[model samples]
Target chain A: MENLDEKFNETIKMGLEIVKETEEDRLMTLSVGPQHPGSGHFRFTIKVDGDYIVYCDPDPGYVHRGEEKMCEYRNYIQNIPHLERPVIHDSTNITYSYSLAVEELTNIQVPLRGQYIRALASELNRQVYTLYWLGIYGIFLGHSTMFMWPLGDRELFIDLLEALTGARVTHAFNIPGGVRNDMPEGFKDRCLRQVAYFEKRLVEYEDIFYNNPLFRQRTEGVGILTKEDAIKLGVTGSVLRASGIPFDVRKAEPYDIYNEIDFKVQYMKTGDSFARSMVPFLDMRESCQIIRTLLDKMPQSGEVRAKLQPNPKGPAGESYKRVESGRGALGYYIVSDGTPKPYRVKLSVGSFRNILALPYLLIGSKLADMPSIYWSLNYWPVEADR
Target chain B: MSSNQSNTQNGSEQKEKVSESVQTSLSKKTETITLEFESSIVNHLVTRFTDKVVQVVYVRPGRTKILVPPNEIVQVATFLKDTLKFDHAESVSGTDYPKDNQIEVIYHLSSYSDEKLSSHVLALSTRVDRNDSRMPTLIDVFKSTEYHERETFEMLGVYFEGHPRNERFLLPEDWADIPPLRKEFRIKGR
Candidate 1:
């Protein structure tokens, strides 16, 4: 006390005040979903101080069926529809990937034309499904008419798909070596007509949704995932593409008959909700172009179905086949032990990664901003939950 | 990708720099890169733990199946997320090898990169003695593991230690004793 002068006494007082202010911070754990309307099927609890959610813990598996366990009991053929149900919107991707698994296990070749049609059907269904993402994006933003138009127009593509595979959502189209059916009568003509119709309607889609002020305001800069943040989170597909990564499975690691076709790969440099939303929307048109090339270039051949029964010789192998589903890089990791059924078939699902990215996107935003961010993502909860 | 991307020429000017310091280690390879790291080096990985041998098949290949012991399931999972850079849990699956009397619980981890897409699988496998059915809980590492571990525990009758919230995740919430995914859990038609 004797050594300290008036100046030293004031510095001590300032240090004491700093410690008092530091003690004012607070943390809380608020669970967001598993049932909440905005957060989807899984739940995430975020610890926060007012608006800034600091720690986000995602608790998924609300829909786990132990399907892999069930797959062991079911025969190889019976597993297609079961796998499709996990992410129902992209059935062709699942069926084709699974079919590749069975074929890779058995060592059979799907006929040339059959492979082309498989790619054609998958990409065609992709356009309609891409439209599905767009419609959901619109509805999430509260634009009822933009919601109705693309969805209503999407029926044209779905109708074409129905004629080819005899079902709407889960066609179970691709079998061990090839597709279940060939393109129906006048299918190419109808497909060409649908393409023209979409070309005309695309102007309206741009006018109503893309150019709309509300849609832009809601998504333009929301949920900005830095490229580094995305890579670290293990994000894939359009979400990663939007972050400016140019890697596309179609071009980088082509599967099916993709290497034979000539088409453009769509990407976005800005990693935001708007960029993420833009991907499937553009891929829809690119799908149309690919289908046009297929109609012109499809090889003239025999039956679409390949060796329709169990392989007699029992050859076993494994391959990680990937395709550009409307979403992103959809891959099937197949393992076989020379059996009719897969020894194990594992999938690296796309939507699961997309689903988890929401927390990083949601943290600082308001509760009201949830739907805009959620819908813009086009992530399916059952996909992650599975 | 264009010819520009395929080239390996070094021109160092970028808006976002790709470096060794980035959280999730990034790599781009020309082949279907398959690598086998020495166990001594692998033992030092973030996902590595005691009593478990973490073999990094490829630092970049994106697919891995960690060999784990029954009791140390929780420890390995904690090490993967907290120590290793594998931040997000992708999916959890179980496989019943009736022949071996052992069940494998696979935990898939997705990397957080806009860097590269890779998967790290941790397989916690143990023999189901039929007399004593028990395994450790991994819910602490991956919050999502609660349901996956519960369903496996229910249908396959594998027990989990310290399950935070263990209830049915797949079958109807009120349904009795696992609704049949195992070979022995008989269904009439099959």
Candidate 2:
């Protein structure tokens, strides 16, 4: 009877301990999870002291399909479909980097016209991606009209890409040697008209979203990532450029025909949320200019693709190539052991790098500023998780 | 009066010389140079740390690989950051060589601060034993390498010494099998 009484007392003590408070109890933990519309297939745990966030821990990989591991099983050509899936809206740029690395590995020279057409598709795809991001960013800030405008304008470019690649989202247009198809007949005039219309629409976006006093008040001085901190954190694309570093992969390390093309690297001196949001818009404007230049400079006629065996294999070597994708610098590091399948493949994405700055920026900020700060970093969670 | 005029002339000449030197140094810092196959950057790194660098080769015009011992990675990374101005790590990737019984970790280093070196990507790599994979972390030198190192650790089971967060990054909390990137860890139905 005494032993049973002692066991009951111990069980009660354990239950009491579970309810006891510790240092962590002072702060309430909230999960901005995948279910949350703002979080978007990613989650982060944050410790809040009332309205202020004290700690942030980003938990990615909810959408991780083990892309790097999957690359080993599939042959070079077969990898394109799934590889482009991570960032489907910006499919061309994702595969463009892979194709460049593969071509370097196999010594496949893309034809002159093929190079121009590839650049054209890449520019069109950039508009599609940025517009989508802008639309989502608008809804995040509670501006529904801001959401509608960019998405509606995005269809113009999407139509152009569909005509060129024969797919709406998953172009898989870029292959190892060259693009899957040449520009369709009348593609040039269609692209020019749409791009000109798109440029006019950009001005309206500035009026409604960017120049709004409410939008300016929320984002102007918030989540300031200084130049030094941005470099130390290794954030890329608009985030890096917004912090005053004019280091575009196209300009810094031009791949294929990017060296021949003349376009300015758009950047901002201020590294605040406002600057980060503005940089991508500026980049879209620059992309339009680039598309015009590429169209003008493209050769009149030439073969689009290089002939290759069904099972293409390269020498025992490795190659790393980077392309300026919509999100940022999407690079592929491929290792080949003279086989049809790659030994190892690593995709170094900008979204992954930019997400590192989240914890650093989110702490000490109000809960209301989370969406503005988070979306301004131009982070795409799926790509980061991949 | 003539002597005073001569002194002023000498002073102006010295001022011009100083400005010229400053201009030259500025140009040297920001000048965008084409990265040749046998570039001077590779030669400099090889010659500077001849003992630590096991092998060095030009993978392509802009990409160079420098292999160092696992033990001396921190030292080499520091030199690359401070002296060579390879400001940031673009990516940290690992490859498992089951035949060689080694797992190689490669840090693709590039520059943003120094425009002259911006075009070049210097891959600093080290190979550790597959079973007993442990290498000193470069996070102290390159702060941006923290997440990349964490990802590499969880994926490959390579322990990064001195790295605070080496736990599961991308993998699930209940991951029980071996690291997924390892050659032995096969994807089902392959």
Candidate 3:
């Protein structure tokens, strides 16, 4: 018995020494890859020390097709179709900024009715994008029901956009100087009814998803990005507003007819994963109100497009214009040297800016909180790469 | 018939004169307001760094441009961030002027804290020789510029001094060609 006790003590001492050695080199590197369902065509390498992430290196550009370089090869109008490809679901808003910049460069004044229609399409597209984001955020947190609900409701807006622009997604409806066509007959009443119904559905979302104890427990305070840190990191869109800064391009810059419309920029002061997710939901509600106002105030009858020469060229100048997309402030800087094709076109997307905050937020966070923290940044991978 | 034509011509002439006068006054009014805002910011910048500021132009009502020497970019950026409260860089874009043998890098700076300046975008630009394009980094001053500076380095081949990670970010790791945004780097069959 004495011999056995001595042997057991020796084994225990050896085991502790092995554990200490492993702890000294315990960081395990993980590649959340381009193939990851949660990562969405983007990859990041994270080194984990036990359960907490010790270091994070985000690797974007897997889907980069040189959109900026491609812009140089195409004419102004031809650029619209491909430019919107980066954020297809929010195509109108993406192209809206480009259109505004092009209009400024060429000195084309869009008629009042055209401006109203453009704003309407933009607001509708914002709803489509936020819903898609909300659905993905839902599934990322293992809420399968949420994934189905928002995506299913998104089809309603898609249908409206199809009616307005003739395509379901990638509606190349917005062009420089004006939209492609006027609103079809009886479209206003149809949009109003569908939007009103969509508002009711939002309450159900709050009950099932937002207020759910499980969702709240996983998301609330999981990744807290302080206001100071948020600004320093250059995050935008819902992420910035979530951090308690009420800066919206529509409110601040007011492109097109947005200045005339009355709507509140919904924001939260929590600056956590939950607040980031919730701000988009609140923005959708505000969007519904804006849509109603737009339809009510639209002119009775007017031209929707300005006549333009084929392969139109602008004088030598540069114009930068920004509009509030679902992700954030999307701006296009166009430099023209009195040519049909732009000399240089630079697209500054919100996702690229917001992704900068990932390393800042991911470090010192538990590995389990990765999805909640990452997706809550409202990052669309394709747009970021572009 | 001659009297009618002359009468119509006289009427058109008077209309043109009235419209021209109205247009001039309207433009003058806008110019005064623009000058007031432009002079305040431009004058302040010129006085602070008289020789560093190469040129100043009001791009539009809300957009302003300041061209500074490449060596003095960091100082101007620091002053803009600390004193002028241009807290963030919205975008950093580079244009290759191959004809001039220079590359122009523009930083579109804006503010969030100052409500009055929220709509304004101050473009702080600098030009460097295309052969050896190098400029100081603004990462220390505006933490938001980390990714933007890296992108400019990779895209335009403008080496940002003191940028910690000046590597291929958006491009493939094995990319051996010239920076893709350069005017000389053409797409296939273009």
Candidate 4:
């Protein structure tokens, strides 16, 4: 008993020294920001008093290239490549909303095959985006193995996407009318095989990362958000779902082929870091099911692209469209005055809304819990700033 | 004296019957109220506050738009939050109309508590003066409008009265040009 007590005291001392408290008079202010590895291109000034965050001020816009302002200068088609640059990894979904909004504005009809292919690309991109976020989330928690596995597996999806769209990273596939082109020969069989293989690897991830006791101890019950607070604060996507509110834009407002596709909205009631992590993990599993179904139901052959004039202009009106991107609900609002270029374009992304809860969640929590909470919110800085 | 006692007893019985009838009518009234509001969100807004809501248009199947005057925006937002259960504001966007010399601000409100209302989007819009763009803030009604209100203020220069912080959110500290979304502020060489 004496030896056990001594060992326990040693563990306690090590934990205390890890998160050192400052002097009462000396409150430390930290800029976890533009230069920091944890924070992306964004910067947030946090004032810590004795290892507890007293105040936090998030400073976004380090990567803002004035995408909305630039949209007014380019015609409809030229804007696709430029718009996809903001969130390059999640390029398909970003352009997907723009295409849907533009389609409503211009009154263009997409072929059924085109719509199915668009949904397929969206599901594939969703996996890539989530995997990229998971990789970053892993590294933030000092789990290097978790970081490498997702990135290494990510290459498989990228290779498949490259075959479909002829580009690996930024596939400027979805235009205003439809996708740039159709699927290549034998693409369906290759896609199904790769997706099925990826699904098997997901089980391995469960064994190594999620089921590990260390990972669970660090994440569970940390940075909890109540259901009332979640809805009152206007958070969307997985963060809201984690709080037990099943408000997925895909389930609530079905765009494209989401209504026809059979799948479930993965959610959790814990509203903590663990819940946030699990929601995306389950979502990746569901994406596999969606991709398989989309492949099976897709039309064999049809016109993928609707031919338009050199520059496509719309009627004098406005349209608002939103899609469930990897981060959250991505909405595009476009106003046109019967001109080739849009009069005003507003891109409301999920990262910005999700980040609003940071200061609320950060205050009074231990500084050690910062990375677990921040990254689990699935914030992408470039996308937020854009 | 005996006749007076009989009259008092009869009066008490009549009072109990009237109270019971009132209870039944009250429940019926509430049932109609819920059905009326639930029948169509657009119709509820149109009938509840006819004067404040200028013109209600059904933009699409899931979207219902209501155009309100700038001053009455607060009133409309409050009614939507309290009477109806539209709990959250999704997006707050401002459009610069240089040709008409006005700027339009639109707020997309949806509900989370009410499952039926969750599927729909209520777009509340109001026009403000272009040069002196000022409108009452809806953050008090819906807390989620806080960040969006700041974005609109910085982007289109539409000053939201009574917002806690109207400072630069997405822009640089030394941004000196006119609001970037305005029509007069042209991009370089555009």
What DockQ does each listed candidate score? 0.12, 0.33, 0.42, 0.30
Q: What is the full ranking by lDDT, best candidate first?
A: 3, 2, 4, 1
- Candidate 4, residues A1-386, lDDT tens digits: the string is 99999999999999988777647446789889888989989899998987899889898889978899999998888899999988999999999999999988887778888999999999999999999999999999989989999999999999989999999989999987778889999999999999989999999999989998989999999999999999899898889889999878888888877889888999899999999998999999999999999999998999887878787887787888899999889989898999999988989888988888889888888899999999999898898888
lDDT of 2: 0.88
Tens digit of per-residue lDDT, candidate 3, span A1-386: 99999999999998998777665398999999899888998999999998999899999999988999999999999999999889998999999999999988888888889999999999999999999999999999999999999999999999999999999999999999899999898999999999999999999999999999999999999889888888777789999999999999999988888889999999999999999999999999999999999999999899898888898887888888999999999989899999999999999999999999998899999999999999999999999899
Each model's fraction of native contacts: 0.19, 0.69, 0.73, 0.65
lDDT of 1 at A1: 64
Question: Global lDDT of each model?
Answer: 0.64, 0.88, 0.89, 0.86
Model 4 stretches with alpha carbons more than 4 Å out: A1-26, B1-39
* DockQ top scorer: 3
Classified by CAPRI criteria, candidate 1 counts as incorrect
Estimate, for each residue in A1-386, the C-alpha lDDT of model 2 and write its tens digit.
99999999999999999989887888999999889989898999999988999999999988988999999999999999999878999999999999999998887888989999998899899999999999999999999998999999888889999999998989999999898988889989999998998899889899999999999999999999999999898889999999999989999988778899999999999999999999999999999999999999999899888988899998878989899998888889999999999999999999999998999999999899999999998888889888
Top lDDT prediction, candidate number:
3
Task: List the candidates ranked by TM-score, beginning with the highest.
Answer: 3, 2, 4, 1
- Quote the positional error of residue A52 for candidate 4 in Å: 1.0
Query: TM-scores for all candidates?
Result: 0.70, 0.90, 0.92, 0.88
Per-residue CA lDDT of model 1 for A1-386, tens digit only, reads 65677778888898888766442357667787778766567666777766665666666667766556556556678887898877776788767776765665566777888988888888877777778777777776788887799889888977888999999888888777788888878888998998988978887788888888888888888778887766655566778788876656676646667788898777797888888888777777777788899888887767776665653224554445556666665656565666666665556566665655777788887655667766666676676545
What TM-score does candidate 3 reach? 0.92
Return the candidate ranking by DockQ, descending.
Answer: 3, 2, 4, 1
Which lDDT tens digits does candidate 1 get at residues B1-190? 2533432232122101222212212233422243222121233442223222332322223333445666665656666666555555544555556787776666665444322333233333334444366666766566544444665676566667687645554455566754355556754565
Deviation from native of the Cα of residue A310 in model 4, angstroms: 2.8
Q: Is the docking of candidate 3 incorrect, acceptable, medium or high quality?
A: acceptable
lDDT score of residue B63 within candidate 2: 71
